[model samples]
Target chain A: MRENAKDPERHARRMAAKQKIMQSRIDHARKEQGVLLVLTGPGKGKSSSGFGMLARALGHGMKVGVVQFIKGKFSTGEEAFFRDLPGVDYHVMGEGYTWDTQDRQRDVAAAEAAWEVASRMLADDRYQLVLLDELNIALRHDYLDLDRVLDDLQARPAMQHVVATGRRAPQQLIELADTVTEMKVVKHAFKDQGVKAQKGIEL
Target chain B: MRENAKDPERHARRMAAKQKIMQSRIDHARKEQGVLLVLTGPGKGKSSSGFGMLARALGHGMKVGVVQFIKGKFSTGEEAFFRDLPGVDYHVMGEGYTWDTQDRQRDVAAAEAAWEVASRMLADDRYQLVLLDELNIALRHDYLDLDRVLDDLQARPAMQHVVATGRRAPQQLIELADTVTEMKVVKHAFKDQGVKAQKGIEL
Candidate 1:
């Protein structure tokens, strides 16, 4: 026996309803709201991943602000690549990593300076992503305060993505995070073969 | 013009030598071997990027492993996406987040258990890339020994790539890194809009 086929108009109506629901779900699934991403682990390529995201966002014409907290010195490949890119706003630790700062006050001052740029970016709703590089360690090291950071982060005007990468994110900070990621060390190349870090590959 | 045509091989030799020199400098730039990548910071896509790398590596027919430290008991879209993929070894936090554990001893014990699997992967050269998700915070919280982790990473069998994502990477770890990235938060949607974290986007 042949089953009766539905009318074309009814079939189209049903399909349209299904498509609408699917589209709605897709839209909801997208992280259109600003997100906090914490990248913690003792591994390589955390910042590389952040740079890669920055590049992709910039490619799409999204404005980006990068505030490196602990690391300032050494010419990074990311800095060299995106310093002049139209949508990129980059700030490095011109003095280098915190340990080399030689003065805690100087380290704190540098962090504050970087945060000034970062804070402005956060306030400006134009940026799609703001990278607070190594900020967690900065806080852990007392370069910045948790209350002030949380307050400022809360005060940002609109939907803006933020990335904080470091190893010792405070409990309060993690609690506040929308998304937390921990990178584990399973195995690495340098350990196995004594290979030194490569510039483009590592930096 | 005729003389230039005769110099093609000479030009190739010079180019090769330049590449070699660049490689050597990159290999020798750092006093330490292996690159420590701490993927810490506040952002939404750290794990996404790491898993993206895993997908690319697997696409290239390389083996990969994912050991999630504190993210079990929660539904993750990434887990759904990669769990069934070939050439991937999956490990989720058997226990939930540390706060939920409420016992320092137990949290340390869980970290140890996860480390067992992660450390094994770090030692094995089978996987081209191993993602140690959330291991940074564990170390920061003193759930694991820095030296022990470094020792395992140093002794890894194959020249493997490792990605560690978290927040607040320690100074010692930063000093040990070939590349360090900080994902700074300049703006965020949650603080401004009070939007609840939706599934797939934040979870």
Candidate 2:
């Protein structure tokens, strides 16, 4: 069957069968609601993809909120571009990187404060999309209670979407998320080629 | 070692040591050049991240080009948002999804035309960043010549960056890329939960 796929007639027949199944699947999916997305693992673009969704939400004229949990020491390109955009409420609440701060108490305090802002957005239906940048790091460190976080997410407005991004997402979060993508590193310029991070690329 | 992270003083000492090594690496990385990034795998966010980088490039006031390969049948939110934006030269050249078209000759022709546009952008220094969206699909289907594509990429402007996105990226492209990320699907809304594609999120 695989070898015969090159034949035009056979290919068309196979595709027709596939089209039928796909059409039925599309017809069956009638539920309309907000989705919870988790972008995690030890590769790049988790935050970038979150920001992309932020851009898409803005394109659709939807109100959105962003809360950064663990990268406040230095400003980023996304922050510079999106901070002042209309319909976007952005906040960077992290004290700094954990190693740079070197204080668990401060990190915990920062995570708590950021979660407060996130929870408010989750409660408000006006915020159609909320991006919790690096929130997984805070969860991994136990700075915030995972159960409380899960509860808040589950209890958010029915039409409000959320995107949580970071590395090493917890099992509970993955299970709860409607969509989850784990980015795996194949090669890294900085690590493999000793190239420095570029402004538009990595910053 | 991980257990002792709770001790503030010990944590500080460990961080200090790590910082020294990090600083040395930072200092050692002196060479600078444009990077080629490949985002691939069977999960979502590859094109989203490519568009995210496109946004990042635009934020910096750099000129960019985008050529979408397999997603031209229907207009996308990104295209609607980015097509008229300043400094963006966007083009969608795919005939349609392979199954939808089911014509190998037409699909190959479309791929060929898309590659022409992409190659032009690669050669032009004015396009600081060029996004070859879903080019890997063309390569995978043998609609476009991989060796020619690689040659064009290698011969691009010295300071030009390129991002190619799609699933099942060839190993040669991965080997040549400065950074490669493979998005692994832990779960999917459309697949696992039978949820339709949402406008702001999936589209």
- What TM-score results for chain B in every one of the models? 0.78, 0.91
TM-score of predicted chain A against the true chain A, for each candidate: 0.80, 0.90
Task: Report the lDDT tens digits of candidate 1 across residue range A60-136.
Answer: 45688888775533335445555666877878754555434445556567877877788888889988788777787
Q: Identify the candidate with maximal TM-score.
A: 2
Query: Model 1 lDDT vs. the true structure?
Result: 0.63
Per-model clash counts, in order, read: 58, 0
Q: Give the TM-score of candidate 2.
A: 0.92
TM-score of 1: 0.49
- Model 2: per-residue lDDT, tens digit, A2-47? 2233687776677677768877877777667899999999987888
Error of 1 at A32 (Å): 4.3
